[model samples]
Target: MSEILRLDAVSRHFSGLKALSGVTLRIDKGEVLGLIGPNGAGKTTLVNAVSGVTPASSGKITFMGRDITGIKTYQAARLGLARTFQIVQPFAEFTALDNVAAAALFSQPGESLKSAREEARAHLAFVGLEAQAGQSAATLTLAMRKRLELAKALAMKPKLLFLDEVNAGLNSAEVERATQLIHQLAASGITIVMIEHLMKVVLNVCTRIAVLHNGVLIADGPPREIIKNPAVVDAYLGHQYAQRNAAHG
Candidate 1:
């Protein structure tokens, strides 16, 4: 597959702290790459920088071969880059369908409201939220809201999607459902950068895993290889699993 996104020594700083430091990586076309790290590992910062939610302090970001390092969120969305937040924030007063339709109409060129709503319903169905389409966003449960977020992002028809903690507060069943949707999207040829704390979800859905700690990328490899790496376990997965593995050996 062709390369779709590249972060060359990207860094983001606030005051004296570096949220992301020289994190270099690339996403090939049609791969689901999971970003795993501790709570403050700069995972979100890295995604923010890449998706134009926040500008990088240093380095280059090339998306589809265009330098888009510090482009604003709206500009990036127009370029087919979209992301879901850790908090699923929809337009509370709008119906779920309208929320998604607004996204489709806003980012996609020449999509009329009527057409957008039709497209929105399809995306909502894809995420298993079609039945709740007419409900107000605030009326939806956490799981439904999360699905709505995914639907809204899909409405944008993004080429590269950043899913930031999509399974944050989900039950096992909801996570499984989210995993399935992620797999479907990946299989459908979307490049995804997923930041997740749920290892089960990551292991199940990611093609490869990237690790970050203290604003630095410590490792990048296939999930199996990543799980076995002592450094990765130490920094993120903890030494308990490693100790058990060693004891068994």
Candidate 2:
């Protein structure tokens, strides 16, 4: 597995406050990398910088072996990088199929509306939303909306997909479904970088986990090792779990 995405000494600041501090990480081809942290820990900021939404203060981002530092958000998509937002951004009035079609158009050149629609249908089916193809985006439930977000991102034919908290606010079953979809994506050779809060989902789906704290990388390893890292326990996994572990010892 070759490295598909790499960030070197990346940092982001807002109004002189650091959002990400010298964060460095890599996502290899055909791997699912989980990014986990408490709120304000710079998980999303690091993602935004990589996806070109926010410019890094100082660093380099390489995608598919090309330097994509400071690349435009839209242009990144053209280069086989696509992302789903933490907040689902559907064209409210469009049908689910239309929403996906819009993304299919963003793929490679020589895509027609009809051709995009056909590809969009496949994406919708992949997300288990084929039945909702004709339904208005605003009419879908929250879980379905998140699925739609995944479908739309997939429609772009991305090689590297950044999923931003797609499991947030879903029930257990919904999370399981999302996990399965992600598993399918990885099986099909789409490298995934997921930002998720749910530890169980991360453990189940991620090949490797990266922990961020105070705008920096604190830990990165296999799921079980990351969970056991003392720094991770101190930084993000509150005292309750740690205290319980100590008591049992």
Candidate 3:
């Protein structure tokens, strides 16, 4: 596969804390890579840095062979890099269609509101939110809101997508639905990097896994291998998880 993104010795510091430390990684086109780590492991921080929400203190980030280390969030969106927040934040007053339309309008230069709304309808439908398009965003349930966030991201027309804990706070059925959407996205040939806690979802949707610990990457490999890796098991996946996985295998 061709390389789609590369991070070379990327580090981000906040005051005296190192949120990311010399994190070098590469993402291939059409890959579904699960980024797994315990709480405070800097997974979201890494995504923020790459998506230009938070600029890296030092090092480089290249997306589609273009340097994007210090680009603003809108610039990243325009460059086909889009991400969903771990905490879903929609404009409460805006209708679902308008919410997505805003994403389409701002991300792509020269896009008009009329065309954006038309495009938003398709994206909302893609995420199974077409019926709720006219409803106020605050009226949607958590599951619907999550799908709306995905619709908004899709409206940006991202080439590389970052899904940050998209399945958080979801029930089994909801998680399955989200997983199916991810599978479809991956099948559509979008390169995805997802930060997910549910091992089942990660294993089901991701082609490869990368584990972070204390602001550093400790393991990067296939799901089966990552589950058995000592460093990963120690840092995040515990002994119980390993034994359970072994039994299931």
Error of 2 at 151 (Å): 0.3
TM-score of every candidate relative to the true structure: 0.96, 0.95, 0.99
Instruction: Write candidate 2's Cα lDDT for 211-244 as tens digits.
Output: 9999989999998788778899989987786676
Backbone clash total for model 2 is 0
Note the Cα lDDT for every prediction shown: 0.91, 0.90, 0.95
Q: Which sections of candidate 2 miss by over 4 Å?
A: 242-249
Pairs that collide in candidate 2 are none
**Residue-level lDDT tens digits of model 3 in 89-200:** 9999999999999999889979999999999999999999999999999999999999999999999999999999999999999999999999999999889999999998
Which candidate number would show the highest TM-score if scored against the true structure?
3
Model 1, span 1-249: residue lDDT tens: 899999999999999999999999988999999999899999999989988788999999999999998899888888999999998889999999999999997787687889999999999889988799899999999999999999999999899999999998989899889999999999899999999988778888999999999999999999989988988998989888777656866
lDDT-superior candidate, 2 or 3 = 3
Q: What's the C-alpha lDDT at position 66 in model 3?
A: 97
Candidates in descending lDDT order: 3, 1, 2
Candidate 1 whole-model C-alpha lDDT, 0 to 1: 0.91
